[model samples]
Every structure is written in structure tokens, then in C-alpha cells.
Target: MATVLLAVLVAGGVGCALVVCLLWRFHRALDRTPPDVGAFAHSAATRTAGAAAARTSSARMTNLTSALPWAVPLGTSVADSCRTEDRNPFLGPASWAPINCVRSTVFYLAFDGDIRTHLRQLDAVLAEQEWVGSGSSLNTLTGMATWLSQAGGDPSPAASQQGSTEPPGSRPICLSTTYGPATQKRAVPHGGLGLRLQVAVAELPCTPSAETGDLQTDGRPEKSPVEGTVYLTWHPLSTDTVSRSAYTAHRYVAALSLVDGYAVQSTSTTAPPSPLTR
Candidate 1:
């Protein structure tokens, strides 16, 4: 009996050791995942919205790190990449204020072009990269499209016209949201955590229609060429432990705007042009 008891104790001790090792590894993983919001802030400030959005978004991401400890895994490689471009005022000698904001690129998509085609192409390019999420939801795509439509400002009269072939005033742009597999609990609310990526395309009003004499031979108003911005966001979602009944999602850790086109041009070196500029 004593021998059996000793054997049981030994097994229990071994089990405890194993559990401790697992806990250590888990915490280590969490440590690796904290996002470098500083990097995101520096990059975002170079865009059209200016540094305000960057500052706000970076603060939100920092808050999220405190909540969702394992949301964004900034592995050694990613951290190194961020450090290489670390332009944080708190850390660096350079000021946080932007010196010169320049237009990065501009491209025009045909008014009636297949936006989904471009989105799919962009998706392909993203898929080739290491940071992108593996899982995709059609529902998320639908949600993004709706959000873009509302955010793009009031729909033109053409959009209001029923059964219109040209999507009323503007063309349809595609948006996609992709997510990575959750490393912790399931992605479902209650107790889930993971990384999310959102990409959206939208048309910008360039030259006024009247200025460009945008009319077809049939006297129908020709829709303006679609000049749009490609918006990219990285954020995290997590369930609240205190209120297990609900979830808490965080703001974007990184948000970037890129002009879409075969050739990108900077219109000005002194100030960034409006994202809508063609």
C-alpha cells in the first residue's frame, strides 16, 4: 500500500510540473503577441486623415493589449521589422509631428468595372504574405461593403434610381475582412481571441462631372471615373472575462491607406492630397 501511495504522489508531482511548463509557455506566447502600435502610428500619420487618426487608433490598440493579451502576436520577426521603422516621438529624437505628407499613388477604376475582380486580385496578393489570416467570412465581406457604402457619403441620385445599370450614381466597390485562426479559445464570443484584417475599396469624386463634361452621346450622364483608396486595418477581438456574457473588441492596431493603380504618383511633396484626387 505504501509503495502504491508513493507511486501516485510521484505521478501527481510530475503532472504539476508539466502544468507549470505549459503555463509558462502560454505566457511567453502572450508576451510575443503585443502589437507595436508605435509602428502603426508613424505609418498612419503619413496618410490623408493626418496624425489625429493615428494617435487615436494607437491609443485604442494599446488599451486592447491590456485587455486581449494574446490578440496580436508580434513575433520576433515582426518586432524587428517595426523597430527598423520606429519613429515614435517618445522613443526617438524625431518629433511625432509629420514634416511632409505626400500623395503616395492614384489610380482610376472604370465606373462600371468589376470591383470584385480587383478585390480578389488584392486578396491573392495578401494571401501570399505571411501576416494575412487564413479564414474568411462572406458575412464579413457583406458587412464591409455596407459600411463602405454608408461611409462613402450620401449616395448620388444615380444610386437612388431603381433598376439602374450603373449602380445609380457610383460603381460598386468590394470589401473583404479576413481573420486568422484563434490561438486561444474558439473565435466565438464568451471567451475568444484572435486577429482580424479588413480591406476596403471605394470610389472618390475627382473632377466635377460638369467640369469634365461627363455625358454620353445619348445625353445620359456618364459616371465619373472611380478614384478610390484602399484601406487596411488590423485589430483584435476578445471576450470579457468579467462579463463572460459579452465580448470586447479593440480598435485597429494598424491602419493604412494606399492608392490603387498600376502606377502610383505623389502629387505634392509639401502636403498630402485628398484621397479622392485622381
Candidate 2:
């Protein structure tokens, strides 16, 4: 009877030990497996990841549009003082200002002739501020030269230095917004385009807006993605060339689109300089 009792006791102890060992092994396997992918990230980490993704997507739009000629990044990268929301003293509710502006490359898709004749003609109709080339005063580009930016209220110092004076064929002549106001400014918003013409004295007639169909004469897309529309008729041009027809008159109209984008951002208080300021 004593031996049987002792044997029962021993069996009970062994069973308990086995159960404890199995439980520990089960816990070890669970720890070895990867954690739930979602729960592992903290809230701050998740937020940062989301913001980075959003920025990446937005940056793509800027990149795709960069293919357009005379394209520039929209920021106060110039002078460092020129801010995105620089206040304009002349017009505004709060005297709001624009910190940055973007202008397209002034290219004449099909000029009447080579750069010289075209510059002379364009200048005649254009105000002294209106030019036909590029200037490095703003930001230099490859192949073509650079030009100064236009601030409607007060022209910057760099603006005076730029004009049609640059080596004509070397780059497009300089043009400014002080020209025939909205209509002319929109035509050559940045400057003039750099012509790669081997043929001088070529004739490409202008039609109603862009209707004359010079841009379409070749493989070029009728409407430009940058300038859009064929003509810069103050607004959008209906055709590709200026109208020489008696009914349309012989006025030389600049054909282009709005180089200045959006309604234009009004000036607001800055978000404060970075803490690690120089």
C-alpha cells in the first residue's frame, strides 16, 4: 500500500513538471516570430512616414513639369532674401506680397527670321523693359542664358542689368513685365526663347491668335505644355502666329501664356527661421 501511494505521488510531480516545460517552449516560439507589422511602429514614426510619402508625391509633379523650357523651382532660392510671401507694398488687403515667382523660357517656336531680325522686330513693339533674350542675373541655364525676375510693383536691381543687349544669337534677348502690361508680359514672361535656327530670314506668318498654324506645320505639338495655347493673346491665343491679314490688321501681338501661376500667393507672416540659424 505504501509503495503504491509513493508511486502515485511521483507520477503527479512528473506530470506538473512536463506541463510547465511545454508552456515555456510555447512562449519562446511566439517571441521568435516577427511582431505585428502595424503595432510595432510608434505614432510619431507613423506620422513621419506618412508626411514623407506626401512630400514625395507632390515633388513628382514639379519634376514632370521641369521638362518645359525655362522652368524654375518655385521658391526663394534667389538672393535668399526674396521670400515666397514677400509683401507687395502697392496692392493688397494686408499689402500682401509674393515670395517667389516662376517664369517660362522665352522661346519663339517659329520666329519670322533669325534671332537678330526677330529681336529687332520684337523690341520695336515691346516696351524698353520687354527684351528677347536670357540673363544669368536670375539663374543661369544650360545652352540658353539667364534673365532677371519681374516684380510688378518695383523692378529689382538685377532687372536693370538684363535686356536684348546680350550676344543676340548666343541667347534669347531679355524681356521684362514693364512692357505692354498684362498682354505683353504674358507673351514673354521669362525672357525670349533661345532660337537654334540655322536659317535666317525665314517667314512664318501669324494667324488669328495661333490659327495660322505654324506650330502645327511641323511635328511640334500645336499647344505647348509649358506656355499652353498656341498664342499669347493676353489670355490664350486661338492660333499660332500673328495676323498679317487685312481683316486682322498688322499689329504684332505676342503669343504666349501665363508664366505667372495661380492667382499669386499673398504675403503672410513667415513660419519663423529655423532654430539653427546662422
Candidate 3:
């Protein structure tokens, strides 16, 4: 019994001593830092907060893209993949790829290019309600909408309906994508930003093709490919400069996946982090 008591005392004493030593070290480190340095760090955080406010700002739209007449995709994932790619085929400078496995109508998604570089840098926070999160919608839409209005041509509803809304070479919808089911498009205003350029794709007939060989090369799993008409639009109010260019929007087909609900977000860009993170 005495031996046990002695051991407990020793252990307790050692723990108390260790805690005291750690506290002392922390105190010393804080004391060693110059007062001016702390002031600068606080100042920096304050500035970052202001910048964060600018990124998540929101605006209401008078028109809704879904209200337009277009073919909407069915059974969720089995459709819309092509239209999603078609609407945002490239997203700035990234390349669009279909990752559908054979035997079932299922394809995963991927991208390639400089825009992919920017997307990697973006802090993507996904949710069923908002695809790219509220933080990104404001920063993405403002410029996209304005770009289409000023420089976009005909929206190139489809290959058959390719017409220049503006003079050729004067900067129309710059990406190599098509927007079928033309309608008056607008981004809905959510208190926290939502996918502004939302589209409703309809079912479209797709046949297995010869070039589908590379699609399954990745060896993901057994699944088929899907193609559908997506009814999405560009946010005329994005703050990002890249989204504002027709060239970029043309390449900006937001890579979407068929998970439950909606693909509710843009893969083209993401919202900045909170001031605290910065």
C-alpha cells in the first residue's frame, strides 16, 4: 500500500511540474514577440474580413432559367451529364471529360486546363442545397451575366442554331459549348448564394458510340453513359473576371455529377474562405 501511494505522489508531482513548464514556455514566447507584431496580425485580419464581404455578396434576378422551354433530364444521373458538360463544357480553360463505365448509363466527371488550375485553388464547399456554396455564387455570376449580355452571341443554343449575337471575332460566348432549350435565363437570389445559373435538363436519346473505348479505360466500374438537355444560364452578376469573358464561359461547362437532389453549384469557381482563414 505504501508503495502504491508513493507511486501516485510521484506521478502527480511530475504531471503538475510538466504543466507548469509548458505554461511558462508559452508565456515566454508571447512575451518575446514585439507588441507591434501582434498589432500587425490583428490589422491584417481586419482587412481580410472586408474582402470576404465582397466575395459573398448577392443580387436578385427578374427571370428564371427553368421557366424557359427546354428538355429536362430524367432519373437524375442517367441524363444531364452531357447537357451539364455542354452548358459548361470547359469552364474557363479546363477540358471536359466523360467518365461513364460500360454496361450501365453512368459516367464520372473530370477536367483539364488552366481553369482547372484556378478551380484547384478555389475553396469548394459543397452541399445539396448549393452546389458551389453561397460564398462562390456571388463571385461567379455577376461577371458571367454581364459578359453574355455585352459580348455573347446567340448563346449557340445548339449546333444547328449557331448564330452570332454580336459580330464574329468581337467576343461572343467564347467557349466551344452549346446551350439548347433557349429561354430567358436568370439567377435566383438566395440569402446565401445558390447556383445562380441553374438549368433543368430533359431526357435525350443516346446510343453507344465507337469512340467510347477511352471512356472505360480508367477502369472505374461497370456503368453506361448518359446524355440529356440541360436548361442552365450564366449569372450576369459574377465578380470573377474570368467568368465575365465569353472565351472563358465557352470553356466553362461546369463538371456535374448525379448524386441525389440537384447538382446545385458551379465547378467553374468557388467562394473565398472566411476572413479568419485568410
Best by TM-score: 1
Comparing 1 and 2 by lDDT, which wins? 1
**Number of the top lDDT candidate:** 1
Q: What is the C-alpha lDDT profile of model 2 across 28-106, one tens digit per residue?
A: 5442322122221223432343334234323422332333222222221000001122132222222223322222221
Ranking by lDDT: 1, 2, 3
Give the C-alpha lDDT of model 2.
0.27
For each candidate, what TM-score against the reference?
0.23, 0.19, 0.20
Question: Cα deviation in Å at residue 18, candidate 3?
Answer: 48
lDDT of 3 by residue, 86-167 (tens): 3233222223222111101122111223332323232121221233323433333333434544654443332222232322
Kindly report which residue stretches of model 3 are placed more than 4 angstroms away from their true locations once superposed.
1-66, 70-76, 79-132, 136-142, 145-161, 170-258, 261-278
Better-scoring candidate (TM-score), 1 or 3: 1
TM-score of 3: 0.20
